[model samples]
Target: MRRPRPIAPAAGQESVWDYPRPPRVEPVTERVTIRLGGDLIADTRRAVRVLETSHPPVYYLPIADFVRGALVEADGASFCEFKGAARYFDVRNGGTVRRGAAWNYPNPTPGFEALTDRIAVYAASMDECTVGDEIATPQPGGFYGGWVTSSVVGPFKGDPGSLGW
Candidate 1:
């Protein structure tokens, strides 16, 4: 697949095209929050953001940051070439439950060990997800957990016709 041309980022913004292929996992101090059905699922000043070429950032909050009993382990697992095996969870918010809405790598690959026990939720499954003060837009596919915020520009991977990107 041909790489799409990256949009030029404005001051203080990042272009997804500039991210790396193997992905980089790093700490982000911005407060991240996730809410669903009027119930708070998570709120944290600490999160790990994974940056990969063609994709928006996917934020992973510590499992401890989530509300008690909010994540119920689900069956089936998938492997990420960079992150290793992932386990899914059914996210519960009050009376609402979104199946396989969250996942984690309990044992991440060598360079991505920071992801162990961290939970990454699909923004589309949440009533709201925010990075700092900015509300997040879910990446345009059900399979990816990336969230698009104004600070990042993208001809992102999940959009239609980007399947081979």
Candidate 2:
């Protein structure tokens, strides 16, 4: 399939088109915070991001940063060709419970071992998710966990009609 035209990024922004295939994982210097149902569930400065071509970055936070009882292992699993098997989590805070809203790879592929102790949540599942001081928008579609911020531009992969992208 022909690739979609990429949106040109501004001076301080990155085009998702420029991200690599097989994805690249790197540390994020900004603070990551997640709030759901009026409770702070996860907060951490030491986070990692996985960037893939045509996709916004997927941020992963250390499991130790989550509040106690905030993440309950849900009954579901999925396999990622690059990251290995992932298990789901039910995120809870106050009266809210988002089932399968987060996931972690207990035993990741070789290059992705850094994710073994990390969890990635769907931004839309939380009332608020921020990177640094900027609020993150969830990437289109329910399947991807990419977080869209001012730093990245896209003709992203999960948009409608992008199934073959």
Residue pairs with backbone atoms closer than 3 Å in model 2 (clashes) = none
Q: What do the candidate models score in CA lDDT, each in turn?
A: 0.93, 0.94
| lDDT (Cα) of model 2 | 0.94
Report how far residue 96 has shifted in candidate 1, in Å.
0.5
lDDT of 1 by residue, 23-123 (tens): 99989989999999897789998899999998999999999999999999998799999999999999997799999999999989999989988999999
Per-candidate TM-score against the hidden true structure: 0.98, 0.98
For 81-130, candidate 2 gives per-residue lDDT tens digits of 99999999999987899999999999999899888799999999999999
